[model samples]
Target: MLRVTDQTMTLAAQRALGARQARLAAAQATASSGTRITRPSDDPVGTGEALRVRARLAAGAQYQRNIDDGTAWLNTLDSALGSATGLLRQVRDAAIQGGNGSLNQDGRNALATQIDSLRRDLLATANTQYMGRSVFAGTSDAASAFTDGTPPTFNGTQGGTVQRRIGPDQTVRVDADGGAAFGTGPGSVFAVLDSIAADLRSGADPTSRLTALDAGMSAVAAARSDVGGRLSELARAGQATADAATSLEARRSGIEDMDLGKAVLDLQLQQTAYQAALAVTAKVLQPSLTDFLR
Candidate 1:
């Protein structure tokens, strides 16, 4: 049988009261701070989960920013190509009119001058830039996609790709192919227009030049289509990233955030329990003779 001594009773009461005090303090801290886990010991697993969710949220935010930049780049490409398309179409129309026998040499020369002006406009369009970076330069650091000369040479990298990471595994090209869009070197739209203008001034048939003009138009249209497709992809990626961020935020809140109603109820319950415990300990550990002498 165990000894029924006052010393043993005192120790038991102290241990019980200490435990009650700890519970009351923990509940008060939770209620005041509005957090479920005050320290790692309170909930280690939940802390780890919250950290992972936060990391995911950060990554999603970055992806969204990339999507935005990519969208802008693609839009710039589309606008430049649209302008080029309009200019090329105008040249095509003028060339058709100039090819007729009824048109006089002076009239043809006038049309040639108009085409030369449009060729300069097209050259400017080919060098379109976004954020000081050439949209048709294919990741190159060149100031312009094409050089300013009699026959503009493409300064852009042929195979280099300007990529934007829109997701953990997804990337999209945001630059246009300069060579494919406006033709590089001698076959360039600028050079082709120069040839047509020369023939018009000499009173020779301008009919042969229309084929090259149509090819230039086709190239610009194709580049614009590609840019539009990339913009659509970026739009979808942005939406997906936003949704993922939202979901991760919710998950993080679930793990770290407290329910005020439940916290308050728990605090009240602990307060009641601790007070009752103090009363019990007081009665059980009544003062001994030594206490009266002091």
Candidate 2:
């Protein structure tokens, strides 16, 4: 049996008061902060889980940013490809007009001048930039994908598709292959346009020029189709990323957020217990003969 003495009683009351005060402080902190498990010691397992969830949320946000940037890059490519297709169509029309045997030399010269203007426009479209980077340069730091020369040589790297990571293990190509879309060296669309312009100026037969124009048009159309498909895939991936972020945030909230109603109730109960303990301690530790003697 524990011996009952003034020292023992005083010690017991102090311990009781300390425990009640600790409980009250904890409840007050939970209510004020609006979060449970303020410290790792409060709920070690829950804290770990919350930390993991927060990391996942951060990753999801980064993926979302990547998706947005990728979408912009793809959209720019699509617009440029569309413009290229339109320019090719204009060149095809001019080729057909110039093929007419009845057209005079001056008429062919006018058609050649128009085609030259369209060729310059096509070159500009190929060199489209986004945020200071060439869209078709394939990771090259060059300002333009093609040099403006007789046969417009490709200055960008080949087969170096730019990519963006949209998930932990998934990456999506964000740039088009400039070589495949615009050809290289003498086979390039710009070269073909220059050749047609020269033939028109020299009054050469338009049959072969028409054939080359059709082939260039077909290539541009094919590239546009490929970019459209990639846009669709990126849209789907973006939606999935948004859903994942939402789910992750919900999970993190569950682990870290406190229930205000429950916390307030608990705080009131702890306050009452602490007040009661303080009143009882005061009565129990009143000045006695032993304390006075000590």
Candidate 3:
């Protein structure tokens, strides 16, 4: 005859009940959180991949921010260059009018005054600041790129290029070299304008001033073109970064996120299983004197 002991029955009931409770708890958690792998142990490989993807997403976000800042800096430079070009064109017109020999000393003096004003305006444009930093000042933190002097000396260095990382392996220069755009020392655009103003004030011929004015105009135009190109590059980089971020997020969601409907169904099944196990354990563990009688 086979012997059925209370100890064996109690051990089997405890094991079955413990397993059922554990599964029920897990299902409830999954349903509430709406995630299949709440802990790394649930899916170690997926967790590792999710970590790496999250890191890349964070880096891409930072790159996008850098691109935005670079774009703003380039826009500021473009505006300053446009303003400088307009001033130079006005100076060219004034030079043309002053070159006429029919104009008297008073007429020449009036043109000189207008040129001086325009020169100051151009100087201001060269020292244009964006977000409290000079746009043409390279990496220098100076309030202005040029000093308020006779020739408007360049206080900022051209060797330092303000660059921004827009991608994993890409960086773009956001600042213009003031020395290249406006020249430096006696050959600077400010110096050229000052000299023209002095000549006009002294009743000198305006025909000689046209050459310098044209050269300055050419330099400003080139700088504006460079800024435009960088703005376009930043736009493309921003779009690519955004697309990459979206892809990474989708990949991460696949690994981390869970289906709410499936989780709820699983929870319901686990609850029913747990209740059935409890009822079976209650019946099996009930004392039956038949074993002792045997």
Using lDDT as the measure, the top candidate is 3
Cα deviation of 7 in candidate 3 (Å)?
A: 3.5
What lDDT score is found at residue 83 in candidate 3? Answer: 91
lDDT of 3 at 162: 85
- Candidate 3 lDDT, 1-294, residue by residue in tens: 999787888899989999999999999988888777889999999999999999999999999899999999999999899999999999988888888787898999999999999988988899998889888888888878998787777878769988999988999999998988998888898888888778888988876978877888899899999999999999999999999999999998888888888888889999999999999888777767985566
Error of 1 at 70 (Å): 1.0
Q: Which runs in model 2 stand beyond 4 Å of their true positions?
A: 1-3, 287-294
Estimate the TM-score of every prediction: 0.84, 0.93, 0.92
lDDT of 1 by residue, 1-294 (tens): 977877787788889889989999998898999888778888999988887898888888888888889888998898999999899888888877888877888899999999999988998888889989998989789889999887887899879999999888899999989999999777888888888888889988877988887888888888899888889899888888888888888888888878999999999999998899899889678777887576
Clashing pairs in 2: none
Cα RMSD to the true fold for all candidates: 3.4, 2.6, 2.4
lDDT of 2 by residue, 104-183 (tens): 99999998999999999999999999998888888898979888888787778776778999899999888887778888
- Taken over the whole model, the C-alpha lDDT of each candidate is 0.87, 0.87, 0.89
Candidates ranked by TM-score: 2, 3, 1
